[model samples]
Target: MSRAYGDDLRVLVLAAGASGMSARAAAARFNIGIAAAIRWLRRERETGERTARRQGKPRGSHLGVHETFIFDLIEGRWDWTYFEKVESSF
Candidate 1:
């Protein structure tokens, strides 16, 4: 996946705004998407932050809450075949 734009490019785009250039024009000039330019401009106007927002932790698995129960069941059946384990899981 593509990475977020850096502060340097954000500053350049915002500077274009200060110079009376439209967000779409700035985006075209910088080879970035118009929506990205608009969003970054909005972020800078609202919060005055040029840096990208921090990403939150990844979501936990749906089965995570049953981890202990699942592990215990497996530990007690170490000799079970893979298919047997799969069938028993249901």
Candidate 2:
């Protein structure tokens, strides 16, 4: 999906600051959320960027730290239905 608000809306909100308009007022004027207007204006002040940030966790950071060990165990003991003997192993 695409971003709901574009750079043009963000620019309008930020520009409203110079005209003594509050973020809340700008948000209502643009039909956007108040928090969104504040966040956009703040981003422009701090980073000079008026676009939404990239979402989600970054690449190459997997949760499977022990994946290799688990695969090795399965490959080395291909004949084992050992979970039946040691239920806790599963």
TM-score, every prediction: 0.57, 0.56
Clashing pairs in 1: none
Residue 30's C-alpha lDDT in candidate 1?
95
What digit string (tens of lDDT, one per residue) describes model 1 on residues 33-52? 99999988888889987788
Q: Predict model 1's lDDT versus the native.
A: 0.86
Candidate 1's C-alpha runs over 4 A off are 55-90
Q: How far out, in Å, is residue 42 in model 1? A: 0.8
lDDT tens digits, residue span 1-90, model 2:
645677677778888965889889998898989888888877777888867777666666463896886677778776668664256356
Q: Where in model 2 is the C-alpha error above 4 Å? A: 63-90
The per-prediction CA RMSD against the true structure, in angstroms, equals: 4.1, 4.5
Backbone atom clashes (below 3 Å) for every candidate: 0, 0
**Sliding window of 10 residues with minimal summed lDDT for model 2:** 81-90
**Candidate 2 clashing pairs?**
none
Residue 67 of model 1, lDDT score: 92
Best by TM-score: 1
